[model samples]
Structures are given as structure tokens and as C-alpha cells.
Target: MEKPRTIPSVFTPQWLPLGSLVLLLVTLALALTGCAAEKKWQYLPATRGEERSIYVIAHGWHAGIALPAEELGDELGFVREYLRPGRYYEFGWGEAEFYQADKITPAIFLKAVFWKNPSVMHVFSMPAEPAQQFPGADMVELKLSATGVKHLKDSLRTSFKLDAAHRPHPLKGGAHGEYRFFTAQGYYLITHTCNTWTAKVLASGGVPMDTVFTLRSGGVMRQAKDARKEYLKLRPDRAEQEGMQ
Candidate 1:
């Protein structure tokens, strides 16, 4: 008989595999937890007062006029579902550092948009730093008429006070109160201020109004603006004879 045969521990082989599996599971769990923790929180812009709010109106290729801001908010649901096709709404507040003072300026902004067939419309408020000062908000309604684009264009000029000639050119891009028509797409972007840095992207891609508003309030306006410009460039040209300049 040989010397007693040496035997390995009965649990040793199983223990290593089991331990490895458990380690792998724990690593995966920790990674997932880390990812969840890293997710960011989205915030809505604040409103100045109950009476003062921003409203955006979109009619499927039709023409319309501005209404009071409060009235617009109350009827937003009806306008979004019945008057337009896809609906997006958003509101929020933001704060910017004051260069001269030790204080911060609180700003509020709102946005809405709708899509119907060949037409898409967007409504956004002027981003007001120290928003409390602006007691009144503007309500802008844009209609894209598939049948008569010219009539819609004229209405925008007359009703919204959009003047391509007198529009103020921002230091870099277009101008304030300047409404430019993309004769190719039959789409126009009108802004009261340069705050439009992101409005263009949201309107073109049909991004929900809420997402755009939230992004802007978070100081990601540049990203939003770039997205809009890229999307608009890729869209089809507006129907010829669709409207007037």
C-alpha cells in the first residue's frame, strides 16, 4: 500500500468559482448603482406671479393672434389637443450671477410647441433675469397653413410684429424681434430676445416643450440651440406658393 493518498479539501474547488461569481455580481450591482446616482435632476422654471405667465400657441398650418398669457395657460390643453397634433409644454425658473452686485438675478421662462402635418409652431417667453420685474408676458401664436402659407406669413408680420427689415441682429446670429422665413421649409423662428439659443432646436425636432424649457433653465441653451439649427437644415423645403414673405 502506498502512503495515504493526499486529498484536496472538498469545498476548495467549489469555493473559488462561487466566490468569483459572487464578486462579479457585486461589481455589476455597484456599477448600476453608481450610474443611477449619477443621473441628473431636471427642474422647471419658476413663474413670477399667478397672473403673469408665458403661453405658446400652435395651430396646424392656420393663422391666429396673441391672447393674454393667463388665458393661454388655462386653455393650453384644449389648444394643444384639438388645435394641433403633437403637444409639448414646459415652464421653469433660473438664476444667473450678477457681475456688479453680490446678488443673483432670478429668471423665469416658459415654452410650448405643436406639430401638425407640414407645419410646426413654437411659443416661448423671453428669458427674464430678475423675472419679477417683467409683470407682463407675451403670448405668441403661429399658424402654418398648408393651403395658404402666404396668408399665415402676413398674419405673423401684422399680428406678432415680426419685421425682417428692422429686426435687431444679435452679436453673432440673427436679431431680436426679427422673424426669418425659411422659404425652403415654410418655417419661421421669432424671438423677442437672443434667448432663442435653444428654441430653434426644440421646435424643429419636435422635442417636447418641457424638455427644452428644463434644459434652458439649467443653462444648456447652447446645446439646445445647436440641435435646432442642425434639424432645420435637414428638413424638407416649404411648399412653393405656400405663403408670402
Candidate 2:
């Protein structure tokens, strides 16, 4: 019989096999953990001369949809009652703990990160005057048509939990100034984060967003900025160019 073929010395070394196994596990772990990089919010280069426009505003650590309440309410009846004679509204979704908690603690953070925490949609009515400037809030105007608005309204309607009457379930004693909280339809988790939800909503409204990479507010704002740039390029004009600055 032919002599038994001996394995290569490199593979036969005592530590070589163990080292290879460890290397494989390390590489797998790194691959699994690698995720999209985080970024800071920035203003979009675009104009605000569009007949009617919507905005996605990035708060310090959160993101919200800002739009004409009248138009949105017209499409989603639940919001009609809360439109409150205001022309615009900013809606934000977040984990109930971070949203409703008067004080933050370790437990709340843990629950928000890992637990299936209840979510809340906060509505803030915006009126025209000295334009309310939310500190550190970066706003991006979205270029959308009437049809796109309808789709956005539909997406917003689905984000809330409806009552028997198909209206948003308003949280009692939740109203604060022009803001209030409502029962949201989804649960908050690491993967289904607030920013991720915002991305999904924007996509439904015909805005081009990379939902997969948008796990943070920065990612959402970055995509919005890119879309705004493209929009301005397509509709260049003197007034629009001024707004781009």
C-alpha cells in the first residue's frame, strides 16, 4: 500500500489548529459587530420656495417629521382634532421611558435598549411667527408632490395605534403646550429604533432614504441632506438658489 500521506507541517503543528480556530471566531465576531458609522446632523443645501413642503428635523439625539398639520390632518383624521389652528406640526416617535420619564436612570436606558418598550408619538404644533428654533435641531426640506404628501400622511396614520373609532389613541393628561403624546403602533428595540422608524416613514412618503444604514438621527439627516441637494439641482432658480445658501 502506498505510504499514508502526511498532513502539511503547518496544519499539523499543535498550536496551529487552535490558533486557526481562534482566528476564525475573532473574525466572525468582528464581522457581526461591524455596523454603520455614526455621524452628526447637518443642514441640507436647498431652498424653501416650494408651494408646500415638509421637513425632517434632527433633534439632539432624535428625529421628527415636520409638516403642514392642516394637510396631514386632512389625510389622517386623528390628527385633525390636534391640528389646533396651526399650519405645521412636528411628530416624533421614541421609547416610552425616554419620552415619558421625568428623570433618566440606568434602568430606563437598559429597558429602552433591550426590552420591548412601548413607544410614543409626540406631536408638537408649529405656528408661523419667530420660527421656533429647537436648539441643535437640523432641518431638511423634502421635495414632495401632492401624491407624496398623501403617502406620507398614510404612513403617519399607520404609526399610531387607532381606537375603535379609528382615531389615534390620545394619552390622557398628555398635552403639554402645543405638544402631546399618543399611543404608537410599534415597540421600540435596538434594531427598530426611533431613527429607523423615521427612515421608514420618510421612505413611505417617496423620499429616498437608506433605512438599513439609518440607525441614528445623523444617518437620517445625512440622507435627507443628499435628497435636498438633488432636489435643488433639478429645480434651480434665482429665489431657489438664494435659499440654497
Those runs of model 1 whose alpha carbons end farther than 4 Å from true positions after fitting are: 1-91, 94-205, 208-219, 238-245
TM-score winner: 2
As a whole number from 0 to 100, the lDDT of residue 127 in candidate 2 is 58
**Which digits, one per residue and each the tens of the lDDT, describe model 2 over residues 1-245?**
22222222211122333455446533543343322233222233244443357888876557788886557655565665754555577777888766766555556655666588889887766654113434334778776766667777888888888878787777632333455678998898777778888887887766767665466677788778877666556567634755878
lDDT of 1 by residue, 1-245 (tens): 11221211110112233455446533543343211122221221122121122223211111112223233332232223222222222221111111111222222111111111121223322222212212332223222212222322232322222235533111111133111111111322211111222232223223222222222112223233333333233332322222333
Candidate 1: Cα lDDT at 116: 17
Error of 2 at 242 (Å): 3.8
